[model samples]
Target: NAGVTQTPKFRILKIGQSMTLQCTQDMNHNYMYWYRQDPGMGLKLIYYSVGAGITDKGEVPNGYNVSRSTTEDFPLRLELAAPSQTSVYFCASSPLAGVYNEQFFGPGTRLTVL
Candidate 1:
């Protein structure tokens, strides 16, 4: 993605509920990713897709689902939300996978599970 991404900026969920956090980019990036950051911790990759219909698990893929059905959309599904899942989620996209690849991130989705 060349420009900023778009995502739901905040969410509050109850235990056991499910919700889909959607991300979209119009710049037609081939590499899109999902990550989460807990309090005082660095970002942990959750999932990523190189292109439409191709996806792979990242470092922390538990309790989450993702699919790249189209080039412009990648939605992260949260099932049975738990307090541990509460964190700042980010969606990012890049044109290529390389050392100097530049990524554009959404503002962030702050999820609070109660």
Candidate 2:
């Protein structure tokens, strides 16, 4: 399976700019998630969706939003981005609930805000 894929492998944003990190999967997974990982820190959940048309906020959803309109796409929108939002964002998915299955992660999209 293609698993999950994220675009714009690297990005730099100024203090109040906006951007969208795209994520897509070909595994037909029922669960997908967006997470941010800071240097030396564990991944922090930003948002997640159990299936198409269903989405929820996660541990660190601030400054971010998501929509699951189709089974293959779930993108993260960063509005009025701040330096604090700078981090490596990863998109992941699993065929089953994360509580019982291992998550497959994208290569990652690195964002830097100034």
Candidate 3:
């Protein structure tokens, strides 16, 4: 299984531009999440989905949107990009949310905005 994969390892977007960060997992995990980490900061959850058609906002969902239409895919969209949005984005999945489940993270996408 391809665990998790994200497109465009690196990107540079201008202010006000919009882009979609693609994420897909082949493990058939029911729980997926999107997170962003800024320099010298811990990762902050942006959005999460327990399953298809069920998504909830997380700690920092202000500048982003997410949707889960299948067990293997969860994509995040960023609108009106800003410099503050420049960070490393990660997509992760877990079989469950409790202690017994381990989250598998993607390689991560690094974005810079000007």
Residue-by-residue lDDT tens digits, candidate 3, 2-112: 789999799999999999999999998999999999999999999999999999999999989888888999999998999999999999999987788688999999999
Q: Give one digit per residue, the lDDT tens place, for model 1 in 1-114.
A: 236455678889999999999899888899999999999999999999999999999999999999999999999999899999999999999998988788888888999999
Candidate 2: tens digits of C-alpha lDDT, residues 1-114: 778999989999999999999999999998999999999999999999999999999999999989999989999999899999989999999899846878889999999999
lDDT of each: 0.91, 0.95, 0.94
Model 2, residue 63: displacement in angstroms? 0.4
User: Candidate 2: worst 10 consecutive residues by lDDT?
Assistant: 94-103
- TM-scores of all candidate predictions against the true structure: 0.93, 0.96, 0.96
In angstroms, give how far residue 51 of model 1 lies from its true place: 0.2
Clashes of each: 0, 0, 0
Q: Model 3: which residue pairs collide?
A: none
Ranking by TM-score: 3, 2, 1
List clashing residue pairs in candidate 1: none
Q: Which candidate model has the greater TM-score, 1 or 2?
A: 2
Candidate 1 total steric clashes: 0
